[model samples]
Target: MSGSAVRSLVSALLLMVLLAAAGCAGGKKEPETLTVFAAASLTESFGTLGKAFEKSHPGVTVKFNFGGSSTLAQQIVQGAPADVFAAASPATMKQSGAPSPRIFARNRLEIAVPKGNPAHVAALKDLANPAVKVALCAEQVPCGAAAVKALAAGGVTVKPVTQEQDVKAALSKVRLGEVDAALVYRTDVKAAAGAVEGIEFPEADKAINDYPIAAVPKTAHLVLAREFIDLVLSDQGRRVLTDAGFTAV
Candidate 1:
């Protein structure tokens, strides 16, 4: 080929390469990250969902902080950098001013006893017996409120050996056999996956706990947060929650 023609061909190839490189490096997209604050009761479900969310959204990371709903709400109020908050109760969601939340699932209180029913806690009234050594959640928690309502519905008055701050703590007492029996959400008991045995009482229906989820106001990953929230309310999310023993809300 002639020298001039060869030079022109080289220039054209270089220009095309530059344009392709520019397209590949467009804007240096920032990594997407989402931080979720969920209730202790949602530990298992959210853990599963977090993994799924991350897998579905490449270049995105989903971080979860599972704890008492009240504690999570307080953290968000204290300026914690949470993108999403899922509370086991509506009262905890009330603390977030970001946006209105929607109910995602519901759970009911159940009597969790050690395997083999060592405490002989056959019914709700049996929990009132002084010898049963019941473990209960503190009044500030949703499970505790359900416990109180279930007790009142059954006309049972009893003092618990211990009051836990969260449902898992209460369930741990039962699993460790530290307490004879404790009241925890049925979904929690289910998530425990046989670590503890659950007993359903007639009054449990009166004390069902509702779970609500919302995006935080100052989320750095608002788009992803909203997407995660949408996923939780999706049919697939509902199926997962139901499989974990939560009722549709």
Candidate 2:
């Protein structure tokens, strides 16, 4: 072969090798994303935890679906492709068939009102006032169930103007001034910070919601799911939960 032609052939082979290496690199899969379905009340705290997990794991991404515990659990049961499930109540977790869930924290119901408590609402019985427009979680959600227990324990009967699907929804009603008050988790009230105020009632002790977390069975990201759960159960996790107004379990 001519010397110039030999040099051109070598250059072409080098280009092909570089192209093949680039193609292989492009074909490599990215890091896996772990999907977590959690209760609506966990929104703020879980969001913080997810970010912390991602920071600790470097290459992994944490995705969250926060909503009513029952709604989330039902979605998971209906095959929503979640790797981890965090429920506000064990009943919902059991209903979803999540195996061996560990209770990580507990929360209690409180009266959530607009920052100023404009309606002058005080105790659980105040919710029964004819002039007060109250919101409550729907009967199906964990927060709703806890509200019912607390109301009964206090011998207070209130007819809410609106029944929300989740604690956040009920809290939204109060935040938006759509209602005088709504019963929601203490953590939720804390999450709202200055937007809303939480009122403690003696009856709240009667109904405490336990937050349970577990790795979904048969998930492709089982190891990551378990690791996330461990992160939640760790001392750091407890601190986060406590800071969010949850009682560590």
Candidate 3:
């Protein structure tokens, strides 16, 4: 009835309307997340790629599950929720049941030693020396399979002090001085950088592993999954992978 009363009522209604609009906007702002399952050897490169993808695609978040290729592949096969699968080996990819996989990169095994090469491991054969404690990836992992092939090519047989589940774990043994040396991917040794030194062996060429990537058929976000895979196969992704020591496929 009064002018001041009417003005107060109008202000209350306007505040309620603004609050309602804010609620609606908040409800509509849901982030898009893309889940990627990748090999442990790809940790560094894929981490960089994921961040880059997030920056380039606003409102999209990239999440990665990095582990041994065999382990990751098995996880995918067991109905794990993943939008994409990036494996370190075709064998693992095939086991994962991810269709239409494309080889994105290649990697070879290298002997990784402590930063100072305390054990003075000079070659692959040296790993066979009973005095040198060595670590290797388990037979199930891609790196382990490569290591076995490389050792056979070099006519060397090593009894590793420990067999790790992944290349990174094997490398970690060298870094922590738990083992005098370990066989891991060149990319992994590069990722370890100053923490470990990579020793290139002639036999490594015989056991190069191909890294493949594919989108999961049951991906909830098909478009985003495809886009992420495309980005990984792009020039920028190649640059990142190369920087991390992966050879382009």
Give the poorly placed runs of model 2, Cα more than 4 Å off. 1-29
- How do the residues 168-216 of candidate 3 rate in per-residue lDDT, one tens digit apiece? 8899888899999999998988888688998999999999999999998
Please report how far candidate 1 places residue 240 from its true position, in Å: 0.6
List TM-scores for all candidates, in order.
0.90, 0.88, 0.88
lDDT preference between candidates 1 and 3, better one: 3
**In candidate 3, which residue ranges exceed 4 Å CA deviation?**
1-29
Best by lDDT: 2
User: Using lDDT as the measure, what is the rank order of every candidate, best first?
Assistant: 2, 3, 1
Q: What is the C-alpha lDDT of each candidate?
A: 0.89, 0.92, 0.91
lDDT of 1 at 238: 89
What is candidate 1's local distance difference test score? 0.89
Clash tally, candidates in order: 0, 0, 0
**Candidate 3 displacement at residue 202 in angstroms:** 0.4
lDDT of 1 by residue, 1-249 (tens): 999999999999999999999998985566777999998988888888888898898888888888888878888999999999999889879976658899999999889999889868889999989888999999888889889989999999979999988999999998898999999998888988888899999999888888999999888778899899998999889888998898975
Taking the tens digit of each residue's C-alpha lDDT, what string does model 2 give over 136-191?
99988999999999999989999999999888899999999999999999998988
